[model samples]
Target: MTFVEELREHAELAGAPLPQLSDGRDRYGPVAAILFAQRSFASVRRRSNGTTLVTVWDHRGELAAWGQAPAVDDVVNTLRAWQDGVPLPELCSAVARYLQAGDPAAAIETLWSVLTDDGEPHLHAIVAAASADPTLRALRPWVSHGTLHLLHATDAVHGVRRGLAFHPTDEDAFKVHVYDGPIGPVQDVASAAATAAATAATW
Candidate 1:
């Protein structure tokens, strides 16, 4: 089967339909538009028009709850905070330090740290179709157990993985590695559902 077909099958299993890729206008925003969502829950998307849209999708993939934010910066900040599972006050302090650093890459690095930090209750199943590994299949249940968070459709960028110690051995090929985050945290269903909804809108 083709890559798209395979991705569709996996997405179906996750109950999170793949976003539309044909429309240039709706494809992911600039590199700054980082994505975060819980499988089959809610999502948040930063639109091209500078609006952050939060949406909640029901089991049928239909919109359930929706909200728009004109204050895009604030919305993005909130989303990042949620992903980090940190208190708002703490995140605000960290953002303040990051902003004072006056470096864009630093900001991206900070965000990447939160998303893929140790035991992040999320699993990233990045595997090459031709590879010999079938481990990803066994881990699929993590999504249902709320142990999995973001399901990256593709591997992250080079710089994004630099500080996280997640370099792929085959720089040219996809590989799978299991990352452990802080243990046994409950899934924030309400927040995830909203974020998933926003992500679905972008598709």
Candidate 2:
């Protein structure tokens, strides 16, 4: 099967639907792109040597950018290498430090990545809070969609399930709304990493 065909079938089977973009024809061949995360575009190009490469484009277009457009460092990486077994959105904002040219901490050029900008200060504060408090020491704090989550510090992927979820509140600067699970309150019995105190116990 062709690279794009296999990719499309696999993505569909995995339940993460990949939407098609413009059928751009570049020097390589007939270029095809998939728009999974907003503004994030990755192309599949099969080289003459039978190697398929995925080029992730970081563009500034009002919509998804063409596969042949200029990128941050114009680095070409294989889909598996670039994805690294993570979701597509990770690639959207993960294009930093390519060749060490741009600021590693600079925000990505996309609306989806920008949505989490409001919680930057809270993210820093939570890190400091977690560093001093031994209870939070074992749990790594992460922010998603402007909400703070504490996950087990297994590895760079924030391995283990997200333990405590904190939502910033307008009531006070230092205050937040803590939830139990990923998107809702923790379960009554099977709610924690160890047991109730880790899960069911209220913050």
Candidate 3:
């Protein structure tokens, strides 16, 4: 089968089906954009004598990350996993890590998975609490090495960004530091979500 046809079949199994290629060719080769939930996510290209190139974009649609896989099937499987349950920040960061280091292990151990692996349920709690408000949904949360960061789709120059350093002052309170800058304890994820929503509107 041709490249596009094979991609479509694999994507169908992945449950994320392929869309029509826009018929655009760039310096690399023929390119097709992929959207998830109607938002721009990644691109697939045939390049350098039929090699597959997968490029991932940041929320602002900037050139932020890329991943080179052996074939379209590898890309499709990753996409399927991302679609199944991975958070946006994690998905983006995985591609970002791979492109940055050219290491698949780095991608797996980077922002998202690092935060999720602690077995403490912080990622789940934070996400569940954040989901209480839809506006806060715009804020994408990512974590790395004890630090949590946020991103927004409308972000242009740097992408909607926030950072927090969590240090528990007491059982009921944890000191949280903001990316723009911070002070005081957040106490819980709901407060953090509200703070994120308010900040996303203006900051």
Winner by lDDT: 3
lDDT (0 to 1) per candidate: 0.32, 0.38, 0.49
lDDT of 1 at 60: 38
The residue pairs that clash in candidate 2, if any, are: 180-186
| TM-score, one value per model | 0.21, 0.29, 0.37
TM-score of candidate 2 versus the correct structure, residues matched by position: 0.29
Ranking by lDDT: 3, 2, 1
Candidate 1 lDDT tens digits, 1-203? 64334434555464544443111111111222223344223344444566555433334332333345445344344344434454334543553222222233333332332233221222332212111122221111112222222232232332122111122223232222223332222223333333333432333
User: Which of 1 and 3 is the better model by lDDT?
Assistant: 3
For residue 6, what is the lDDT in candidate 3? Answer: 72
Best by TM-score: 3
Error of 1 at 50 (Å): 4.8
Tens digit per residue, CA lDDT, model 2, 83-193: 344343443345322322122222122211222222244444444444344455444444556554554444232233345554444312323334433344332211222
Candidate 3 lDDT over 1-203, as tens digits, reads 66656767888886776564333432222354343523445556554565555655445544444556676677775555444555555654663333343333333233232233221344455544544556544444444443344555344335444433444343334545666576655576666556656655575
What would the C-alpha RMSD of candidate 1 be, to one decimal place?
19.8
What's the true lDDT of residue 137 in model 2? 47
Candidate number with the higher TM-score (2 or 3)? 3
Candidates in order: C-alpha RMSD to true structure: 19.8, 15.5, 15.3
Model 1: per-residue Cα lDDT at residue 100: 20
